[model samples]
Target: MSMATTATTVSLTSVTLEVADLQAAHHFHTAFGVDPHIRLRASEAHSTGFRGFTLALTVAQPTTVDSFLGAASDAGATVLMPAAKSLWGYGGVLQAPDGTIWKIATSAKKDTGPPTREIDAIVLLLGVEDVKASKRFYVGQGLTVARSFGGKYAEFASGESSPVKLALYKRRGLAKDLGVPAEGTGSHRIILGSTAGSFADPDGFAWEAATSLAPTPSTESAAA
Candidate 1:
């Protein structure tokens, strides 16, 4: 029996940050030109445009670097780098809270410059059991389906051309191609922006959908 092969083209879905204190993190981010928009929630704030991914600050007690590594290991999160003291100061590695290897760091660098250029897009790739069904559901939700490859894959443009794109694919093939071990059904997950609730795809792939607010202008000049 020939196993079906899925294409290997994975786009970034979302990036999230978890901080110890929402207020303090918000203030620090603001100092770096990353202004957080206040919504109805007190502990949550988000950025505007492609500039902001998602920021979450919870009341987790500070753990030693070793403890943090242990927690990540227990959570099945891959450790990109072991925690260690660095020239920049502080120490942390890159690891996803749940398997994905996102960069986790404790930066000691001082804020010496303005914010970088805004992001151009946020890409979302979903791994699904049934691509046809997922496509149908998205279409039913009034989203325009742009590009599709048979019943195996589909892509949708947010219609704004703001660089945010959503796509769905078969789970096993997706995981295989991405080199991510299969973790059962609905392995895809998403982290939606502040307003919209985050969700996981049929294959457990994570995703988040949210309208971005405009950013506040800064008086500081860009860093060299």
Candidate 2:
């Protein structure tokens, strides 16, 4: 008698992280080596690799983790670690509120290089109402305003705490630059780093002011 044979197939899916701020999370992830072309929407960010996996970011409050998990009962997102105050003063975790196990932490013991990464290089831009006022706010928050071009653009840095430099520019103009469609509110998003606070520009462009994490090896390499 002949026996029948069947082949099994498997595919990798996208990984999404629920963050308090979309733009901030984008900034942080970009610094960690995620590409920006994957960001498909204002509220959503994406990154891709040949390894066939994706990373996404969605907004959620720290206190809502339990509720989010409850809704994703079938999705298999378990709390690898519960949400709690981090040693760095912000909420930290090593799990997703509604997905597979992933490392999520608020620490900057990653990048130790000066904050020289350009905004264009990392796809992070700040939208502000008043460039000068925004510059002042960042400076007061411990960032060093490196320079201000004309009266409409400003650059700030936090040294080795982050890899990307922060910028403050006119909101509408920034939207035009990024080719973002006109919408209602003009709030930006940013991810707080272990050593810096994530915030938006005056115009609402989000930014992540944090250090980069070391490059993670591909799963194939581990298997090999």
- Scored by lDDT, the top model is 1
**Total clashes, candidate 2?**
16
Question: In model 1, where do residues sit more than 4 Å from their true spots?
Answer: 1-121, 161-163, 184-210, 213-224
What TM-score number comes out for model 2?
0.39
CA RMSD for every model? 14.6, 22.7
Model 2 C-alpha lDDT per residue in residues 17-67, reported as the tens digit of each score? 333444544543443333332221233323221111112222133333333
Model 1 agreement with the true structure over 1-224: per-residue lDDT tens digits: 11124232223222333332445434434432224322111222332112111121111122333444555455445555565556644434433332233222334343234422232233445567788988876554445677899888888755431233566767666555444454543211224332223444443334355445334311211110
Q: Each prediction's TM-score against the native?
A: 0.41, 0.39
Clashes per candidate (backbone, < 3 Å): 20, 16
Instruction: Give per-residue lDDT, candidate 2, residue 32.
Output: 35
Best model per TM-score? 1
lDDT of model 1 at residue 40?
16
